[model samples]
Target: MIEYFKSDARLLSPLYEFEPGCWVNLVRPTSEEITHVLATTGVEEDFLRAALDPEESSRVELEEDQTLLIVDIPTLEESNVEQDESKIFGTLPMGIIVLPNTVITVCLQDTTVLRGIAQNKVRDIHTAMRTRFVLQILLRVAGLFLRNLRMIERDFTKIERRLYDSLKNEELIQLLGLSKSLVYFSASLKGNEVTMEKMLRGRILKLYEDDRDLLEDALIEIRQAIEMAGIYSSILAGTMDAYASVVSNNLNIIMKVLTVITIIMTIPNIIFGFYGMNITGNDLPFAYWWWVPVVISIGGCIGAWIYMKRKDLL
Candidate 1:
């Protein structure tokens, strides 16, 4: 759907139709809507469709009077199955197109970055000031990254606690999912940082003093988020490796105990087998006594247990 929003007295107000100096927000627009936006806004078709592709990397492009800036935005996907993980974090591309007449944003999904502006959560928003408006959006995106990264950290802690209590596949799988989320956040944040750096140069988009400061703030947040992603990723990877080693060691210990028991239990089998043979009791007085083998087996088991205990294998 496409919506028109223009800042009136520094507050966002909805418009029924397109207007100059207004913001055009597109969220999963249809083919007809895309065509209409292109014809009405005079934005390049490529710029309109740039962010629709999920694989699109963050970058800035220039086409005469128009500037297309693509950045990665954090997203969360929730699972409904009871056995599956509930939250999975990822990223998607959001396109910010600055035209001579209007500013446009296109994305395949609605994002909190846009919602904050639309909801008047951001201060000093002006759709007519295209450069400043774009900076505000970038700042919001950076904030969203930090927000999601913190949540991921919290999730890591929760899963880590569960894992410490019991070594279960469910908890380990959740940790793996959290690790993957950090990886995605890291890559996306780096891509966005590069794109923001290009804008910081004041080459692709014009930047006034205030606009430059705003962009710098966005960059700082992005850099901090990048650092956090890196740190979290490293810690999670190491934790997973350590857990794997622990599991392997535990399995080895269990198998050793089972093997020792099997060996000790074989003593009774051997003694009973000899007595079951034909004419086996003729040469021995106690050979016919069933209690003799039973006593011997019990003594043998005790000795084996003592040996194993001394070796620290039991």
Candidate 2:
């Protein structure tokens, strides 16, 4: 869908049709809509497609009539994946195109950043100030990354607690998924940082003092998020390794105890087995007693228990 918005006294209002000096927001536009936007706005189809691609990286491009800025935005995919195969999330690309007459944004899915802006959540917003408006959007994207990163970390913490009580494949799977998510966050955040640096260096977008400050703030947030992702990934790796070792050691201890018990129990059987064997000339006076075997077995058990205790194998 294509949404048109115009500035009205520093606030945004929807427009029925395209007009000069307005913003055009496209969310998973249909083929006809894409053709119409391309035909009417003179934006190259490839430019929009690049941003719509899920695998697109963050970058800035310059054309004859427009400038294209592609950035990775954080997105969550909800699914009923089995506990073992759960996943955290990934990213989608968003295109921000600045034209001579209007600003155009294209993305495969709707994002909260656009909705927030439309709802007047951003202070001092105006479509006529295209550069500032784009910067504000960039700031919001960076902020969104941070927000989602925090949630990921929280999930990791919860799983970590559960793992401490008991290690399970399900918990490990969750940690793995979270680790993968951090990787995506780190990559996307770095890509966005690069794009912002290019914008700052190329001077493609005019910035006032406030715009520069906002851009810098966005960069700071991105950097912080990158650092967090790296740190969390490392910590989780170490934790998983440690838990695996713990599990192995625990199994070994249980097996050792069982082996010791089996050895101790076999001693009485060995004694009885020897006693029961017939040698024609050998007989003890107590051997005729019916309780003799019982006495021997009891004695054998006591001896084995004492020996095991002394050997510290109990």
Best lDDT goes to which candidate? 1
Steric clashes per prediction: 0, 0
Name the TM-score of candidate 2: 0.91
Q: Which candidate is the best by TM-score?
A: 1
Error of 1 at 276 (Å): 1.7
Residue lDDT tens for model 2, 116-228: 99888988988988888899999999889888888887887788887867777778778777877888888888899899998876477877888888889888988988898
Instruction: Give me the displacement of residue 115 in model 1, in angstroms.
Output: 1.1
After TM-score superposition, the amount by which residue 270's alpha carbon in candidate 2 deviates from its true location, in angstroms, is 1.8
Residue by residue across 101-199, what tens digits does model 1's lDDT show? 899999999888898789999888999999999999999999999999998888788778777669988878788788878889999999999999999
lDDT of 1 at 100: 96
TM-score of 1: 0.96
Candidate 1 — worst ten consecutive residues by lDDT sum?
78-87
